[model samples]
Target: MNLLLARGANVSDQDGSGTPALHRATHARHKAMVSFLPENAANVEEKDEDSCTALTIAVKGKFEAGIKLLLSKGCPVNFSYKPRVSNTVSCT
Candidate 1:
């Protein structure tokens, strides 16, 4: 990765689907890869084609270590791609 970076590759470069390097790292359960990412890895926060952030995948995958690593790197806990909707209906 260092060589790639030196060759002008962006550490935050996402795939055509916007899945960043950190997302792949989490999926592969690569602890070392997590550390290698910039300290501000969370800044990428680019969602995949499914609109799922790395944090969301880590949480759902039950990758406790990866989740903690992302959190420590500044990933927001309450990040959501879509706004929440209230169940209450308006009274006419």
Candidate 2:
């Protein structure tokens, strides 16, 4: 990924489902990659097709290191997954 970044890969580019590198890293439980992406400019606030943020995925997966890393990078602790509902989930 370092090489990819050096080669100008977009850190924030999203897949078809809008899942970014940060989200994928968190989902995979790769704490180091999770840390690396944010440092490289991946947005922790980005959401996938399911309206899932990296922090949300981290919390759901119980990935402690990932959750801390995202929160430290300033990812929002509260966001609404369901439209017009509420900030139903709290990553913090």
Candidate 3:
């Protein structure tokens, strides 16, 4: 990843589903990658096709560390998985 970054890779690039590298790393539970991506300017709020943010993915995946890391990096805590849906899930 460092090499790719050094070569000018876009950390914010998204996949076919509009999932950014940060979202993938969090979903895959790759702690190192998760920690690395955001520091390099990966959009913490980038959502997938389902409108699931990195924080939402971390919560669904039950990744405590990932959740904390994302929160520490300024991920909005009040963000809902789907707007207008009263069913909100908690990461804590």
Candidate 4:
């Protein structure tokens, strides 16, 4: 990953679902990758197709380490998500 970043890969690039590598790493529970991506400029607030951020994903997945890392990096504590409903739910 370092080598790719050094070669100028876009750290913020997203897939068709608007899921960035950072979110994928978090979903997969890759602690080292999760920690490393942020340092390389990954956006912690980036949301996926479901409007879920990496922090939310981590929390939903019950990944304590991932949640801690995101929080420590200053990922917003009040992220908002509106599922298919008309109401917005807050993930803290």
Q: What is the lDDT of candidate 3?
A: 0.81
lDDT of 1 by residue, 20-92 (tens): 8878888888877776784634353566666666677677667899888878777666654342365221211
- Candidate 2, residue 76: the lDDT equals 91
Ranking by lDDT: 4, 3, 2, 1
Assess candidate 4 and give its TM-score to the true structure: 0.81
RMSD of candidate 2 to the truth, in angstroms, is: 4.5
Can you tell me which runs of candidate 1 are displaced by over 4 Å?
40-44, 79-92
lDDT of each: 0.68, 0.80, 0.81, 0.82
Compared with the true structure, the alpha-carbon lDDT of candidate 2 equals 0.80
Model 3 TM-score, all chains together: 0.81
Clashes of each: 0, 0, 0, 0
The candidate that wins on lDDT is 4
Compared with the true structure, what per-residue lDDT tens digits does model 2 show for residues 13-52?
8877677878888889998888888898788778777677
Error of 2 at 65 (Å): 0.8
lDDT of 1 at 72: 76
lDDT of 3 by residue, 1-92 (tens): 89999998999988886778888899899989888898998888776776678889888778999999999888876765442356544332
* Model 3: residues with Cα > 4 Å off, grouped in runs: 81-92
lDDT of 1 at 35: 60
Show where candidate 2 strays beyond 4 Å: 80-92
